[model samples]
Target: MNSSLQLAVPATRNRAPVGPPFRRQARSRLLRADLLTVIAWASVSFAVALWLADGGAAGFSTPAGSFTALGIVAGLIGMDLVLLMLLLVARTPLIDGAVGHDRALEFHRKLGKPSLYLLLAHGALVAIGYGIAEGLDPVGELVALWLLVPDMWLAIVSIGLFIAVVVTSVVTVRRRLPYEFWYVVHLLTYAAVLTAIPHQFSVGGLFAEGTWQRWYWLAICIATGAALAHYRVLEPLVATARHQLRVSRVVPEAPGVVSIELTGRHLDELAGSGGRFFIWRFLAPGMWWHPHPFSLSTEPVLFDSSGRGRLRITVRNLGHGSAQLTRLKPGTSVAIEGPYGLFSTAARSRDRVVMIGAGIGITPIRALLEGTPFEPGNATVLLRGHSEAELYLGDEVLELCRRRGATLFHLTGPRSAGEHSWLPEPAVHSGHRLASYAPDIADADVYICGPDAWARSVISAARAAGAREEQLHYERFDW
Candidate 1:
C-alpha cells in the first residue's frame, strides 16, 4: 500500500462565471417539457377520478360523490404535501453537503415546477367540483366554501408552498440570498408537507372506499414524516456530533488547484477510498457558503498509522466558493461532511481497466490509480487534453502508471475517431484494438469519469462495442 501523498499548491486565476441554469439550454424548451408533463398528470388524474365516480354518473350524488371526491383530492393533496416537504429538507446546508449543491439544485429543477402544477390542479378541481355540488351563487359559494369544507385551508397552505418554491427557483433572485437564509426558508417545505397531510385524512376522496386506502395514507404520512425528521433534523446533527471535522492545513497547488487537509476525532471513521467525493463546508473567514462537491485526491488513512486520518481534496477554482478556497490558510476550521458517490477502484476491478479524464475531472481518476492497490499491467490510462499546457496533472498520472506497471496513453490534441485505439493513432481500427485487448467486452468492467460530453462518448463507445450496462461505471459531475 502507498503511504505518502503530495498535492499541488493552489494559485489564483480568472474563471468564467456560471450563468443562470449553468449551460445555455434555452428555457423555452424546458418549459415545453414541463407543460407536457403537467398536461399528462392532469389527464391521468381526471381519468382516475372518472373511473372512481363510475363514469361521472355518481359524481352528482351529494354525500356519496362528495365523499369519493374528497378521497381523491385528499390523497393527491397529501402526495403534493410530502413532496414539497422533502424539497425543503434537502435544501439545508448540512444536508446539501451530503449530495453537493449542484446536484441538489438539479433535483429541485426536476421536481419543483411539476409539483406546483399538481398542487394547483388539485386545488382548482376541488373548488370547482365542490362549488357546483353545493348549488350556491358564485359569491356565496366563494365566501362559504371553506365554511362547508374546511380542507380548503390545506389547499391554501399548498399554494403558499408553491409560491415559495417558485421564488427560490428563480436564479437572479436566489443568488442575492445567503446560503443560511435560503436554507431556513427552504425548511418551510416540511411544514407545508405536514400541513397538507391532515387535509388528506379529512377529505378521503381516494381513502373512503376501503381500509387499504386509509392504510396507504397512513403509510405515506409516517414515511414522509420520518424521512423529513432524518434528513432535516437528525442527519446534520449527527454530522456535527460525530465527525466534528476541522481543516488542519490548506496548501496552494498549481493555478486553480488547492490541497485541503482536514483532521477530526476518529479519523478512522472518515477513511475512504479514492474517487469518492465529499460535501465540504469551510465556515471560517475566507471560506463561506461555498459548499460544493470535490473529489478525494488522496488516500483515506489516519494522519499516520497511529494518528487520526487526513484527507486531501484538490479543488479547481471554478466560481465563487471555489475561488475563495485558494485564500484558505492552515487552522481555518471547516466542517467536512460526506463520503458520498461511488466512483472508485472497486468499480474498475477487472482484468483490464480503461480510464478517461477531462480537465480537472482527472482528480478522482488520479486518486483511484495512485491511492488504491492494483497489480501492474492490468490498467491503462488514456488522457486527452486540448494542448500540452492544459494538461493539469499528466506527470503525476504517468508516474502512477509507472508505479502500478500499467501503460499510459496521452493524446494532447483534438480527438479523432480512432485516436483511442491501440492501432496507429491517425487511423483507428476499431476491431483490432478490441480483438487484441478484451475481445469479449462483456468480461471487462469500464470506469469513466469526466465532463458530460466526454463521459457520454465513453459510455456510447463502450456500449457500441457490446459492453453490458452493469459492466460499465461512470461518475458525472456536470451541473
Candidate 2:
C-alpha cells in the first residue's frame, strides 16, 4: 500500500546540472512537430499534383468538367486527411515523443469536421457533375452509380459511420456518452474505412487500376494501417507477454482512491523515463476489454537481477470501468500498452522544476518526483485539494520532498471565488500568486496535472510570470 521512492541514491546536496541543455531539447521537439506539419500539407499538395500530372487541369474547360475535377481533388485531400488522423493516433513513438499525446490528439480531433466535409463534397459534387454530363438529375445520377456497382452502397454506409464517429467525438456528445459507448463507436471507424475503399478505387477513375497515383495512395493507406497494427496491437501483445504482469494487491489509499500494485517479470523494462503511463487491460470476465490509462504512482521496485519486480498505479473511481477495478482480485492477468507520452525528464527544458497537482492528478507528479533528477532546494511541489483527504498521495509526496530537500506546499480549502484564480480563497485574499511560491518559475520547467480549468489557471499564471511555452508541461487525463 505504501509507495517508497525508487532509485534512492544517497542524497547529494551538491549535485550539478546533468541533463541536456534546455534550449536544444525544446528546439528539437519544435522541429519534429514542424516536420510533421510539413509532411501533412505536402501530402495534400502531392495529391493535387498527381491529378494535374494526369491531365486533370484540362477537364475544367466546361462547367461539368470543372465540377468533376474539383470533386476528385476534394476526395484526394479528404482521404489523405483521414489517413493522417489515423496515423496520429496509431501510438507511434516518433509522434508521441515529438508532439506528445495531448497535442497530437488535439490536432487529430480538429481534423474530423474538415475531413468529413471534404468527403461529403466529393460525393455530392461528383454526383452533380456526372448528372449534368449525362442530362440526368443529381438524384438520378446517384441512383445510377448505386446500381452500377452493387457494393457502391458500402460507400454510403461508410458515410453514415463517419458521421457517427465524428459526432460522438464532438466535445459535447463525448461528455454525455459513457466511455465504453464512445469507445465502441470509435472502433467502427476501421469498418468505415474498409467499406469506403472499394468504391473509391473502383468507380473513382482517379484510382483506376494501373495508375501510378493509385499505387501511391494505396501505399500510404497500407502504411497507416500497418502503423496502427504494429503499435496498438502487436507491440502491446509483446509487452504483455514479456512482462507477464499480474495484480498482486489493491490497497485503499483514501475513501475512494486506491493503489493497484502488480508483480511482473522484467518490470524494469516498463519503467520508462519520468511520469510515463500505461494503458492497462485486466484479463477478467467483465473487464478484459476496458482500457485504463494510468501512470505509475511510484517507481518500479526490482527484487532481483532477473528484473522481476513490483509497480503501482493509483486509481480513483472516475468511471464505471475504474470503479470495477477496485474489486480486482490478486493474480488477475494484466495486458499493457505502455510507457507512452513525454511527460517526463525527456521534456525538461530547464534545471529548476515546478510541479503542481490537484486530486488524483497528483499521482503522475509523484512518480515524476521519485525519478526526475533535481538538486536540493531546486524543485517545488504544490498539492491542492478541498481537504487533506482529497490529496490522494500527499503523505508520500511530502516524504519525497523532504528526502530530496525540495520545497513542498499543501493548499487545501474551497476554491477561491475569483473566476481565474486556482488558489484557495484565503491564499488569493492574502495576495498569493504562482510566482510567490516558485520565484524561479520563469527559469524552471513547470509540470501541472489537475482538473482542466484549474490546470489552465495555473498555466496562465505561470505564463504571466514569464514561463516559456517550452517550459510549461501538462497532460490531459480526460479519458
Candidate 3:
C-alpha cells in the first residue's frame, strides 16, 4: 500500500458506506429523482397486473405467472432501497459549516421517500393479493401474508421504522431540532435498516431463497456495518490519537476581525487547500467532541520555514465558539482534526478559473491561487467587501495578481465623497458591466468562497452565463 494511504487514526467513529461512482454525480442528487421515476412506473405496472388478474384471467392462477409479477415488483423496490443505502453513506464530511452535510442529508431523505412508498405498496399488494385468494378478513389477510414466512414481521417493522426516519428527517422538523440530537436520531437508521434481516432472509425469495441469498445479506450487512462503524467510531478514534497544537498568537485585525495562529509538530502533514478547513480547538486535548472549523486565509507554507507548517486562521466573530476564540491567547493548547472537503479548485476539471471572495472567505481562494501552481493569467479574482476598511490584504492581492498576470476586480460599497484608488472600476450591479469586469466568465471554471449568500449569488450568475456544473466549485465559510 502507498505510504500516504495509511489510515491516520486506528479507526473512525461513524462513516457512511461507499456508493458507486455514478452516485457521486452531483453527490447523489439524482438518486431521489430516479427513484421517484421507478416508483411511478412500478405502480402503474402493478395496477395493470391487478386489473388483469381481477378480470378472470387464468394467468393469475399459475405459480410462474404470480412469481413473475412479484419478481418485477420486488426488483423495482429493491433497487430503490439499494440506492438509498448508498446515498446515506458516501456524503461529504461535516466541518464548521453545515451546508455540505445539509445538502447530502436532504438528498438522502428524498431518495428514501420513494423507497418507503414502494415498501408500502409491496406490503399492500401482498396482503391484498393473498386476501382475495383466501377470502380472509383484514386481520387474517395480514396474518396470512406473514404466514408465507412468519419472521417477515421484521420486514414489516423495518418498513415502519423507515417511515418514521423519513418523517423526522424532513426539513420542517429537522431544523426545529438540535443538530446533535437530530444526528443521534439519524444514527438509529442503522438499527431500523438492520432489523429487516429476518424478513429478507425468509420472504425475499428472489435473492434469499437459496444459500446464495445468505451470502448476499452477509455482504450487504458487512459493508453497511463497516461504514457505520467507521464514521461513528473509527473517525473519532483516529482524531483522538493525534496530538494537539498550542495557540501561539491571536492578532486582532480589527474589533470584529482576528487572525489566530498555531504551532505544532506535524502540522505540515495536514493536507489542505485554500477552500478547506479543519475542526479546531475545542475544550481540551482528547476531547474530540466539538472542534470548530476555519479556513486558512494565507498560503499553506511551513509556518516558520523550518518544515513544521504553521496554521494561520482568519476568523470573524460569528457565534458562540467564534466569539469565545477571541479570548484565547498564546500558549493555549488546541486540538484540530480534519483537512476534509473537496471544495477547493483542485476538485475541478478545468484550467480557466473565476473566483469570487466575500469577507474573510477570501482565505482559501487566495491560498490556492497563490500557494498552488495556479497562474493568474488564467484566473480572475472578484473581491467583495463592505468597505475599503473591511477589505484586508488589498496590496498583497494586487502583488500576487501582478506576479501571475491575472486580473483583479475589486467591488466595494459606495463611498461618501472622494474617489478611491482601490476601487478600480465604479461598482455596478448591472449585468453587462459585472460580466465585463471579469472577462473570464465566458469559459473559466468558477469558484466562490466566503458567505453562503454571496456564494449563492456568484453561482447563480455563473450558471446563468452557461458555466457547466462540473466547472463550478464553492467553499462556504462563515465571516
Candidate 4:
C-alpha cells in the first residue's frame, strides 16, 4: 500500500476581487430553485381545482360522500406527484441545470414515501366509502371492485408493485440487496404507473370521455414519459454516437485506484467545469449494462485543430460494480449521460474557494483545482485520508496547486479518538480544524466531497466557522 505525505506551500499572492458576475450567477440559480418550488405546489393546486370546478364539494354533505370525494382528490394529487417524481429524475436539462442532478434526485427520494402513502390512502378510503354505500365491509368492497370493475384488477396489481418498490427502497432493505437487484426492482415503477393508468380513465368519472380533466391528466402523464424517454434513452444514444468516446488507456494511480482516459470527438463541447460527473457505461460484455458515475479528475484537453480531445476520470474500486472497471481494456466504447452536479465553478459564489476531500473523493477536488476559476492565492485545498495512498491522486493535486498558486494541505493519519472530526488524530490533537486550514472560510465557497459521516463533520466545522448554507457546496458520493 502507498502511504506518504505531500503538501504544497501556500502562495503569498493577493486574493482576487469579488465582483457582480459571481453574485449574478448565484442569484440566477436561487431563482430557478424558487421557480421549481412554485411550479410543484401549483401543480397540486391545479389537480384539486379540477375537481372543485366540477362541483366536487357538494358530495361532502354526507359522511360516505365526503370520504369518496376526499379519496378522489387524494388519487388525483397522488398521481400528479408520481408524475412529478418521474420528471425530477428524467434528466431534464432544465431541472438538471437549475438544481443539479443530485439535488433533483434528493427531492425525488423525499417524495417517494409520501406519494406511496397518498396512493394507499386513496385506495383504502375509496373502498371504505363505497363499502358503506353498498352495506358491505371494506375488505368485501375491495374484492368486489377488483373482481367486478373493469381495469380495477390492474390497478390493484399496480398498488402492490408500488408497495414492493417502496419497501425495497427503504434504506435498510436497499442496503441488503445488490445494486443490480435494487435497480431491477426499481424498474417496476414504470410498470406500476402503466398498470394504474387504465383505471384512471375507465373508472374515474372525472376522467370520462370528452372531459377536459381527462385531457389535462393525459397530457401530464405523456409529458413525463416523453421527458424520461428523450433524456434518459434517446439523448444518451445520440451523445454516444456523436462523441465516439473510446477508452485510450487505464493508468493506475494507487492500489485499486486508476485513471481511465478517453479520446473523443468534439470533447470540448461536452466539457463543463471540473468536479462535475458523468454517468459512463462501458459497452463491453458483462459491464455494458451497468453505468458508473465518475467525475473528471482532469479538465478535458482539446486539440482545437483536429476537433479531438482527451478526458480523464480517476476511480477507486469501492464495490463489485467498480472493481470490474479496473479490468477494462483499451478501445472500449463509452456512453455518457452527464456533466452533472453543481460542485464546479458555476457554484462559486466568492473570490476565495476551499476544497475539502477524503479518500477517493479527493479526485474531483483535483479536477476542480485545475479548472475552477480562482486567483492563485485565493484557493485552498485540504485532502484527508487514513494513509497517504488513500488520498488518491494527491500528487497530481499537489502539482496543480503549486502551478496554480493555491495552498495545499495533506492530512493523513488515523482518525481522532476523542471527537467526531474529519481531521487526522495528530491534527485534531494539535487543535487544528477546518478554520485553521482555511481562515477565511466564512467568505469562501467551500466545496466538499467524501464519506457521508466525515463530510457532515466537515460541514459542521465550516458552519461553525461562519459559512452560510448557500456558501457550502457538496457532492455526495453515496447513491
lDDT of 4 by residue, 93-157 (tens): 78877788888988988889988998998999999889988999989999999999999999899
Compute each candidate's TM-score over C-alphas: 0.69, 0.95, 0.68, 0.95
How does model 4 score by TM-score?
Answer: 0.95
**Who is ahead in TM-score, 1 or 4?**
4
Candidate 2 lDDT over residue span 256-301, tens digit each: 7899999999977766555878899999999999889888999999
Clash pairs, candidate 4, are none
Backbone clash numbers for all candidates listed: 15, 0, 18, 0
* lDDT tens digits by residue: candidate 1, 1-479: 10111232223323223223311222333344456446435644654454455433465477545643654554464364345336433444333323334444556566666666666665655655555667654455545755666676665675687569567756676778865576677667666665666665565354555545456557655765676566645765677567666677777656677778776666666554577676677786655555667877766556555546676777778777678877776776666545655465434324555666667777787887775444454465655555554446667786777656655665455455543432223324233343234344555556677777667776776777777754566776743
Task: Output the worst ten-in-a-row residue range by lDDT, candidate 1.
Answer: 1-10
Model-by-model lDDT, in order?
Answer: 0.58, 0.86, 0.58, 0.86
Better of 2 and 3 by TM-score: 2
Error of 3 at 476 (Å): 4.7
- Candidate 1: stretches off by over 4 Å: 1-115, 136-151, 163-188, 203-215, 231-233, 286-289, 304-307, 345-351, 371-375, 414-442
Q: What is the lDDT of residue 68 in candidate 2?
A: 87
Cα shift from native, residue 168, model 3 (Å): 3.3
- Please provide, for model 3 over 1-479, each residue's C-alpha lDDT reduced to its tens digit, 9 standing for 90 to 100: 00001012113223223222321443443344456446535644553454344442543575444633553365345533644454355432521122343344445556767767766776666665655567765468787556666777677677777777777777788878765576677665766666766565456354433354355446656765676577645764465345456777888886687888776655555544666666675554333354577767765457454446676787778765577787776877666555555556435445566777767776666766664344335667777776655556655666776666567766776421222222222433222333665555766667777666556766776776777775677765521
